[model samples]
Target: MSGWLAIAGLGPGDEALITPEVTEALAKATDVVGYIPYVARVAERPGLTLHASDNRVEIDRSRHALEMAEAGRRVVVVSSGDPGVFAMAAAIFEAVEVGPAAWRALDIRVLPGITAMLAAAARAGAPLGHDFCAINLSDNLKPWDLIERRLRLAAEADFAMAFYNPRSKSRPEGFAKALDTLRQACGDARPVIFARAVTTPEEEIRVVPLTEARPEMADMRTMVIVGSSRTRIITRDGGPIVYTPRSVPA
Candidate 1:
């Protein structure tokens, strides 16, 4: 590879969320490669070349970025939220010269960003302070049966749960399926935190019981957090927050 691989994270959605370092990487890069939606987030940077692709075309995109770098071009692989969290960083590494010749010739740097789970947790007043696990209910990449098994284990262990790709417009029933699994293991009253379009326009956060997390309440843009048995839902002066106790020195 010709240049450094900056796995820059575009924080949340606001333009102000972009850090000086991230901006510099974008400012200096000759080629910027990323998923289509993430690449669109980059405002017109003068003379920057962009290679955007479909969402599922991750490996191809990574390979393309590497090819550009091998051609003596500085390339920055962009990812929304943290590049490592279900994003480009892993794909880049996977493609980075795995062979002795490949590993010896490439340079890569992983830059992290504000992940949706953390952003959503912040809006909900810390529902993930203690032991927690994130699960994607989508069966597109992973099988639904195994996802169901993780849901059972997480709920049974009373772990705080953050769901990425919780639901989509077409197969919106995934969240419902997850909730059903959780409710079956943890009972119906498990606290559920819903955040829509976090940090962007039309951001919304609310807490409901697990049994009450309706399909109408979520979509592709929504990230859902389901709390454990220790989670508490507070309604103070009509503002809602879901709090999970943190264990200090005992």
Candidate 2:
């Protein structure tokens, strides 16, 4: 509303997921920009311009959003999940890598959203309550070798991992490779979770051993949680849940 480009988060699919700050910013925004599917989730917002695009054009989208803000538009760039964790925040910052001082001074505020990892972890109990880390399986921007190295380190360290951007039509085998590496360090039967769509309609939470995961379930919409050696899985109220056990007194 103040002619500053405020990049806000709309959280997950549910409207109740939106925070008060995000709602206020959206109400005052003259325009919003995000991936088409994510932008479509905001059904009640009216009297505002919306710019939606494919996920592949991330840099272009940020540049365009900022350009509109520079033209005195109250712009709100949105991300489906959280803006900071593997979302639009990085892209917008990347767009300003070689910007003018004035361009850098443009007001930009990022609001946090409920990411699929946190939502999935909550549904799956306290699997990530320990010293866990996250990794993206899609190697579009980063090479597979780098992913492989990280997976190797995570496996060696016995860290519980949340796998994001697991698979898509073009990149199918990244999960398999990561799983294979994990199996060598842990065991073939190590507990792993395949959580799909999260809070959305197509939610699927499957408790499968590391070796039992099929490539069919891995996709961009899915978030996979690989447990550490101390993690355990059980059924609770007809839902699969994972948790790391409390440490024993020495």
Candidate 3:
């Protein structure tokens, strides 16, 4: 089969953060499929078709990319941030698992990019320097009860946390409840970093105590990170640096 499918990450928001491997795949792709904003990032060129679709249609998008690849079209599935992190790579695999028998034989690849969680953590001086865990705060795919359970458990284990899809206009209460959960579970007044639109022109990074991290301070565009008990702040002339110690003294 000459056709292949490449599930690629476009990085967070900055074009420069996109990996050279993903850029090469896009250049070779006969078709690009992704959410509207991600597809918009790919430059239009001759012999390349872009398929932009709505959010919640991941399965359909995956299937379409698979079919196109089966038909010998070089297809690239794009996602902002690392495609495997709450993004399109898993969706593509999910479709392939239940798809036609021939799909299993198709050449498929997942190209990595800088995920928002890491990008956000980097902007905050490695608040994730120690052991950490990433969680999707959006209850769209999972129950809120499960999310809360994991939140409490991660806190109980003293793991620094990075949250994605923290708040949206339609789901304002969830993040508020999350903040409350962390405050009650963590107990200590650790730092919370809110990195919004990282690497973009509108990028904003705000550091505040866990007690002051309001739901309103975060939006869908924001990456929220809550530090663990071992996390410390280095106050400097410019700004404070938040980082978790690399070791835990037993």
Candidate 4:
């Protein structure tokens, strides 16, 4: 049997958020590969082999998946949220690009899913309804200077921002630096949302003014959204609804 490889997104924490295309691909896969947690999300079956590895071994994992596919095994490489968004899809392409030329001819497809940014935005009443940009705040592959520049530029452009990999046990100071940079650049009371483990049983959403926002409010699991100056919050008896107007004034 001719084998193929698919890079699929499992969506944020909720299984229901996973796209039908990804589910179908997973069900048909003879081998599944991903980070330990993401691979754990897939159920075991008689015919499927699961390959789980450390989070930092993405390229290694991608090469393994490609090798499996080359050996005539249908493979699905899983990722949390969208595979194209800071996930396995890019890593797979990178591996393909640098590996054997025959690897380029292998069948490969990317299946998108709901990213945490969108899921968090949906639960927060559309903070990203207007122009926005998503940034990965971790300084792992990139330097902190670049991240700071993007943050400042995004603030200056008045674009709403969604931040991923905001904080971790090792890099606890990054988020704090980010908050200070935003506070200095934006210089306004726009709303900032802290959405933790969104769409799961541990979900927690907190809305606070930018001035009052703290670094500790966010972690690796948190999706942080900072509104543009044009963003607004409508308060009611139920709760405040945060959204950016569809139109911008001249």
Candidate 3 lDDT over residue span 101-201, tens digit each: 99999999999999999898888898998899999999989999999999999999999999999999999999999999998999889899999999999
- For model 2, the stretches where C-alpha displacement exceeds 4 angstroms are 44-46, 235-237, 246-250
- The C-alpha RMSD in Å for every predicted model, in order, reads 2.1, 1.9, 0.7, 0.7
Worst 10 residues of 4 by lDDT: 233-242
Models 1 onward score TM values of: 0.93, 0.93, 0.99, 0.99
Which has the higher lDDT value, candidate number 2 or candidate number 3?
3
lDDT of 2 by residue, 14-102 (tens): 67778899988888888889999878765555678889999899999998998888878998888877888888999998888766555
What is the per-residue lDDT of model 4 for residues 82-199, given as tens digits with 9 covering 90 to 100?
9999899999999999999889889999999999999999998989999999999999999999999999999999999999999999999999999999999999999999999999
- Candidate 3 has its poorest 10 consecutive residues by lDDT at 117-126
- Worst ten-residue run, lDDT, model 1? 97-106
Clashes of each: 0, 0, 0, 0
Q: Model 4: which residue pairs collide?
A: none
Compose the digit string of candidate 1's lDDT tens values, residues 1-250. 3565677888767677677788888888987888888899876667788888998888888888877776678888888888888788888877774633554476677777788888899988989988999987789888899999998988888899998888888787887787777878987588888898899988988788887878678887788998878888778875787889997345
Off by over 4 Å in 1: 97-100, 248-250
